[model samples]
Target: MKNSIAIRREDLNKKGEKRVAVIPELAKTIIEAGHNLRVQSQKHPETNENKRAFSDSAYADLGATITEDIAGARVVIGLKEVKTEYIAPNTTYLCFSHTHKAQIKNREMLRTFKDRKTTLIDYELMVNADKARVITAFTYFAGYAGMIDTLWTAGQRYALAGQLHPFAAIPQSIETEDLNIIKKLIQDIGTHISENGTPDDLPPFINVILGQGKTSTGAQEIYDILPVENITLAQIPEIYANGDRKKVYKCVLGITEMFRLKAAASLPAHTYAALTIPQKESHYFQHPSDFESNLQAILPYASILMNCILWAPQFPRLLSRTFTKAQWEQHQTLIAIGDITCDPEGSIEFSQETWIDDPVFIYNPATNTSTLSMEGQGIAVMAVTNLPCEFSADASTEFSANLSPYLPGIIAANYEASLENSQLPEAIQKAVILWNGEFTPRYAYMQDYL
Candidate 1:
């Protein structure tokens, strides 16, 4: 079992990524099961600071080696993307490669696998028999961090507006120790809002969520900590003008509610309009080009917008530049947004991935520009790419729990054999993007991206 499995250190260049693929407690089990483990030393040779949430000594104490060279191990696992040069020949690597759609950024990395004879198993594609995600802790935790950071952005934005508020006291996500502490702080804020209402100059705090998926739900879970009143989209303007200022109002909008048919290119004008809501939804799903951004009706009255949709270029833009400016003129209350999805210039036209070091930006839609300062008439966007890293220990604990059950078996599996005849589980086998330097049948389409 010598060098059976190794957990690589996260890339040092990636700031604020302290989470590890495996924790020390889990490493102890793998060792007790008679599999050798090597955890990359978090002790950077140049710096005294341990970069990882878990210390190297924690793994070493549990019969795991704290080694600098984990690439030589038969199985190397990580949380994020690994460099192409780090992949040892004939070795198997498990991580989120993010090249399933043949992304332009990772084309070279995918090409490197073909010559190195290394197996690339993407965690994102690891789905159970029922097609449910096997690794979901990260997505779920991301929502928690995104909304928390969004609140931080609101505090900062409000302070810039010369409005002194209690929320302005809340720190950034990474500044806090864990989710429990953050939740307690938010609960305190909720109590404060109950005792003293939000600023009268501003409208009611209407939080409009864009999707209903796991990420969206995670955001909702965090938002629920506040004294909130769930309301429908139809009750917005009236609610904003007359609703209790102390209570935060929430409205969740699905894709169909945010986007609509453009010009009826798919069917007759009247027939398309006459279609039932579900039928229209199906049609819009099949042909996204027929849809146009319809968020103007929802965006104007919102104090904060949490975008959690999994979107691409083919989909209609939800918060376009023109729409952002128009909405600002109407209400000026949509000041802060938590783009939890973090798609760069994707659905939310102005949002780009911001790092934890600089997690938010003021997007001036009027000038099509952004500034790091949260000042000016523009809206504030908190779009941290690796949000879960804010609560690294908690995130790592959940990730380790989900991935630990599969580790002992995967470490003991026979990778020398063909992938079809390998000892890997069916779900894991299906997730293999590359096997021994060749594109697996399921991932052969990736060649187009390279």
Candidate 2:
């Protein structure tokens, strides 16, 4: 039985990705379940100390082998996209490939997957029959850290503009020891805002959060702790007019509010309006081109924008570059944007890649130019590509628990057999983009990329 499973160390290309796929506790679980386990070491030629939350000896203490070369392992699991050179042929690999939307970056990697007869199981595509996500720990944590980092940048942006606010006191997520510490500091900030109201020099703080899924929920969990008022979209102008400086105004924009039917005016009276909420959502999703962005109504008043929408090309961009430049030309009130969706111009149209070390860049809507400087005129965009890795230990612990239940089936899956004769769980089978050298039917549409 080729029952050995290994964890791949993140490659050098992953600049700030400091997470391990398998932590010590999960290593023990895999070993206890009657499988040989190996984890890649972080050290150069096996250094005693590494950056992982757990020591390498911890895995060895749990009756697991620690080595650098996971390439020979029959089954390898990891986080993020595997480096092209590190991808081994004829092995079953599990990770987020980021190739689903036909990303040009991974086009060659997909070609490699086909040519090398690799069996790739993408963690991102592991959805049920109805498209409900099964593994979501990473997403929630990503939002959790994203919000914290958002505050960090928002505070800096304010300080640069010489504004007096409590947000300037908040620290980045990576600076904290853990999630609890981050919460404590934010709670203290909330208390401060409660005791002393925000400065009158600045306009009303109208914070907008896009999307209501786990990612948005996690961000709101942190945001709601602040002295804030949750407002409806219709009440935005009222809040801006007579809102309290002691409180931050929060608004969540879902798909229905983000987009409106472009053909609504052409339809008969109460035609699109008569449809149920679900019906409207389905109609927009099924025919995205029929809708146009309705986000401009809220943008001019928003102080901070936290974007967490699931964006694809078919759907309209949450903020088009053209719209952003035009909107800023009139009344630009946006201060900072926490683009947790981090698709680099996919959702927040001006969002470009920023790293953990230099985590923020100022995107100038006026000039359609960007600079890494925190000061000057532009919306400070905090688009850290790997937010979850800032809370790597916490994220990994939750991920280990979520992956626990599915481990047995994933380990026992028969990848040697043909896709038709395979014994993988139905959900897992559906996530397999490549099974035994051939692209799965569901992913056959990716053929055009090659």
Candidate 3:
């Protein structure tokens, strides 16, 4: 059969997930190859002020069929997970199915795919020959939006406490679609800090960033816009005790520095060296139980915590209720937490995934509950799950550019052929989680989860 690919609209249930897997420019490539292309009519914000990466009309103009009939196509594509009810039997579906981690919530969705005999390909598992990720995600933007939002939330928290500072002058991430506006705001905040210095009313401000991965790099980009000093972890105490309050500080932590063996007071030099060494078989600490959280030592001095680490069920909580409550009672300087990973009850135990419209909530350690407003006693959390949507245009363009290389292989695959005989690229073949409803060999481990 001739290849026919369909691009489905993002699930409406997920707010701010406005990204499209196949932009119009890429759609033209698929159409020019003499293959059938179908795109769902995407819905956008009603106001013309909101900037969209591309219009639905743009897809139609490229000689592609634009409609809501996603089920009619042989291969379906999307940015996020599709609803199980929309999964057509015997059809190949490609998207980010988060079930790789055996998430309980997605167990039923995986079972439904098996029952419907649908072929599932997960984008997250697409890796190169070296097992490194081929599709670089919008993680940088997640950090960018997260850091910007964290500073804005901290400003609001200070206002509620009747403390005025330079952060108050900053704007929300969504206030303007143009990234330059946000960059200028960050620059302005830096200028103000450099000139007037931090207010005496506020405690010494230190931003602790966890993980030095792509997410942290993105967060640092926004943070560097401010006139701040980068200090080593060993220097934190000295600066906190005698450093200038007028200036801000930043510290980045790696895996070894963030956690130590549960039984040992500190990680030994050999173990630390083994983990720190690069290109050495990628060996590190085996299990989460082997380590204990080492974040408590720095909690007293932090004004903002940007968590960029990837956490799973096996990992220990970065900050527990007891620790947070004690710090809150002491009236610690920590005011805002940017849980950029947005894992619900994951790394940051008090964290819950928040929407773009309602991005922040105050987590009351005393009550162990959350309130929408940043007022009252508690630390404010900026946990927007879909941070990239704030810069959807640029994110989509980057995402599509990375995905373009695999398009021909994806569209030309013969779904009828046996899994091993299929003409898909090795990367795509490796990403197949389900073949005709049964778990693929690479993903058979998910069978227990099902």
Candidate 4:
């Protein structure tokens, strides 16, 4: 109903922080790893609770060319996926958090990788599920409270993976082993639904809700009735405890409709409500009509919240996004966009950094080549961008002013490239071809079918 923040100058710059702060953190990790971390951002040595966890630069030494723009930092990383501009031909990139998109994008920047010329190593493949589970959960919850879309989007992605099945609800009467299998399947189903769902497509997959049966009534009662005993036997409880029953039935109807018409809605309305927040926080609380789009960015990582909050208690951020009153009220909405999430106490922000300079595997068609760049020597790091929510743009311009000092140049560079038709430099282009050939092609292939 309001002007999209994307069109707002101040809001756009504020949203641009995603790119502005990555470099210094990457540099910090590199520095800690005993490597040099340089960035263009005006740098000052600062640390936080998470950063404090790292050993006192015991294992590695890192230095960076600090810069105000994250784009510059990303440029130094020599990662092609983030930008398509320059190639530090000789600079070896070491990064973690490798994704298919990043893989292809990097290859685009370093064209030499596919020519049996360069190297790209994906260290993320080595990460165990446990580690991913920890970080994933925290981000997922933040995605929910903040109305981030990527979290819910994960279900749609899984559907694209060909992991969807008919609605098979977990039965209360089933054996523990059977229930476990159902749980796994449910998780898989959820993943597919999120990853593949679109406004035009089917809801992605069917949900099988196991109605409360007499045999396993206890568990069912716990899930279905909640704080109430089986006071009476009725078609449904007084209220849908967590809206589970209603969602399940709706899923059944949606799935049936999909089969009949060969089409499905992007998502069921019931589930969508749980997945996103309704209250839109004004960005920076400055403009009254700076609303552009709802924050649908957290969908891909939705399950992360369940994992972090229920499964792994080690991580703290699964609770919420840390935002100051100013930030909360500033933007047209309350939540952030992508993997970046706020902390539990709403005091800090954190995000997973996997592929800044990951070992990139690429294939070159120009010279009929395969290449590896940034192999093995990758770094894994997390960033605590702006102070949780304490520093607000309206309260004081200090944050805006100081942000440039800590912002990563890579962020700026990517923003610039995004505006420039998403083109990368020559070398990076080759690298991207190879990267796409290996990783992105898998998804791209499926997309072709879709």
Candidate 5:
């Protein structure tokens, strides 16, 4: 379970609110520190009935305020920002969100903090190192188990494609520490399920936390605000059992529907921009918020598949060599690749000739960019683990499905030729494929030509 310092939300006037649930232990620590916790509340001009209900209150006595305006109260104690209207200029801002690019982009606010002498600290930096170790153990276990429940079942038993558990990516693009923290949380979940009978015994936030390891609990918890349809057991791993046509179709349909939604929502804004085929002069149709919202929706489904292999029974034994900290670090370095422009009309070439080997790419202390180049490579390897079925990370079949769409023509083509058809010449084929596969074609090419 995450600590209260990681949860607790409060409004000044609302005293009886249930509050955003957090790790109880973390909450106690803040109380013991005697820091006055505060949150922002929007005064609804339309309704005076609840106006000023929680206008002012200390962090310690939050019960009444919480109950009155549950939605109005902001969870400030753990957040990076408590709106300027709510807190004193001197109030400190402590939260993981502070590290995210969106928040950091607010240079004006940061300037205000500096001018006001308000201490803006990332508490995660202080507590996460130790917390991550414990968290990792649990998340690794939960992720490992959840993958099994979601992806594989042979009768009552489950099987794994490869002998090893796959590596799970920490999606927090900025906070490497939080990413580490999330990885730990996943390990913890895996441990709990392996030891316990039900994943229910654990806090729901724990699962949300694992799924949204990179996001703030406040933002991540908002998904619970959305309606989630109950997924029937028959729609899950049952296809591996009875193999009923109706059941299988329903299952596949349900999955395909979900994937469509996920893809739409998860597709990057840049991807959308690429799809838009903008004219020389253009007006943007979507807001950044829209992109952010949709991205959040798609990520959970992706995670469902990404974590599949982690839970397989055979995964722990077969892929042990790859999931280690050293390997994870190596893998982590590879996940971050460069961004490329795509042609909306599919006429332009977006291809890479080669992946230049650069050791300095991992951690260029001199330049201060540690994870940028590594991202692409990491994404390439992560493609295998990101799938929803039994597949080896080392297998070309899995790699092609998970990553090719995201890859440029050169890199993706290189991956296909090198891994899928080993009989093909590596040096000549890789080079030739990049040259020919430069631009995305207007029409999809059939792999089999009769």
Candidate 6:
């Protein structure tokens, strides 16, 4: 029998997630391949605009059946995880199921997939022969949006404190998707800063960025639009001591610079380099307890903290509550934390997953409470979970292009076949987190988490 596939609308509750797994252009490809293609009708959450990335009319025009009967299809595709109650039994569902690390929050959802005998394929795990990610993500936009949002939040906080500067003129990321518009705005801000210089009221400010990955690159792209000075991690202390009220300074730190072994004082420099040189791989730190946070030295000088590194429960936090409180009380220079990774209570312990509409919150380390406004005595946190959604059109187009190649194989695969005999491509096979409601061999480690 021919296979049937359905593309469901993202959960309405997930605001600003305008990305569609199968765009209308890809719908045509699936239909031409002789598979039954269906798309659920959906309206853009921003109803005032009345625009959707893939309108129902567009899918229908491409010869795809437009209907709400998603459960009728054998295979379901979506951009985000579907609610446990909405997942139908015995269906192949593909999405970014963030359960790879045994996330406590997603344990119930993973259990539901097992109980329903649903096949769960996680997009994040889709890898090529090199074990590198095959699925393109919105990481670039995450960094871009995060930096823009963080700068804007910092401006707001500064304005409330009666200090007006170039950042005050900056607009929100959601206001426009045109990179040129943002560039122009930042250019103007840069010009203003160069000519007028920062106000004497505020001290010399430095933006410390952690991680050198795509996310960090994206943040740097936005920051580079201004008249900024790049400083090395080793020079941070000297720059802070001398102070540069004329131009904004940025420092990017790698893993070796950001962390140290617990016994770094006694260990030889060569031994430390050997242990931390291969930083990207988990093998570097055999245990989380082996490392101590080295971020404190920079905290006293940082005006903005851009955390772009990936963090898991097994890893030590880059910024702890005690450290944050001490910095806020003593220096008062760290105005905002742009947590691009947005791992709730993961890396930046004080940061919580915030929404796009209300992107920032003031985390009061003293009370361990968060306030939506920046008026309180706390550090502003920009932790938008869906940062890339700000540029949904661009993100969806790139993601669809990357995901198209695997569609033909996925649509033709026989899910009933045993794991070893499955017709799915190796990339897809490796990505299957759950097969027939049980953890695949590659993902069996997740059983303990579930």
Q: Candidate 5's residue-wise lDDT over 272-328, tens digit each?
A: 545433420122123211211111222212212122111111111211222223334
List model 6 lDDT by residue over 326-355, tens digit each.
Answer: 666766668899998988888888788888
Model 6 lowest lDDT segment of ten: 43-52
Taking every candidate in turn, the Cα RMSD to the unseen true structure, in Å, is 1.9, 1.9, 2.9, 23.3, 25.6, 2.6
* Best-performing candidate as measured by TM-score: 2
Candidate 5: where is the Cα deviation over 4 Å? 1-80, 84-87, 98-105, 123-450
Off by over 4 Å in 2: 44-51, 263-269
Model 1 lDDT tens row, 1-450: 334888888776667888987888888888988887888788666565566899877888889988887756888888788787676788888888878875677778787876788888999998899998888898989899988888889988889879876679788889985799989999999999988988888778889998888898888898899999999888988998898978788999887788877774667668887888889889878888888888878776888899998887777898888877777777566879999988877888888878999888888777889987667768899988899989999999999898876776677788888887777887798899998888899989887877
lDDT of 2 by residue, 1-450 (tens): 337799777766666566776778877877888888888775535344344666778888888788876766778988888777888889988998999898888888888988888998998888878888778888999889999999889888888878868999999888874999889889999888888877888888888999999999999998988988989999998898888888888999888888877855344436778988888888778878778788888888998899998899888887888988888898878899999989987967788877787889888888999898687787889998888888888888888777777777887667778766667777788899998678899998887889
* Local accuracy by lDDT, each model: 0.84, 0.83, 0.81, 0.24, 0.25, 0.82
Backbone clashes in model 2, listed as residue pairs: none
Which pairs of residues collide in model 6? none
Candidate 3 lDDT over residue span 1-450, tens digit each: 468899887776677677777788998989988899888777633432322357878989999887767676889988777777878888889888888998777888788888888899988788999997777658888888889999989888888778897898777787775677889877877878888888876666899999998889999999988877999888887877777866789999887667655665254646655653441112234555656677877887888999999988877778878767876777567899999998888888889878888888888888888998767677899999889888887778878888899988898888888888888888889999998788888888888986
Candidate 6 lands at a TM-score of: 0.92
- Give the runs in model 1 whose Cα sits over 4 Å from its true position: 1-3, 268-280, 329-331
Ranking by lDDT: 1, 2, 6, 3, 5, 4
Q: Give the worst 10-residue stretch by lDDT in candidate 1.
A: 42-51
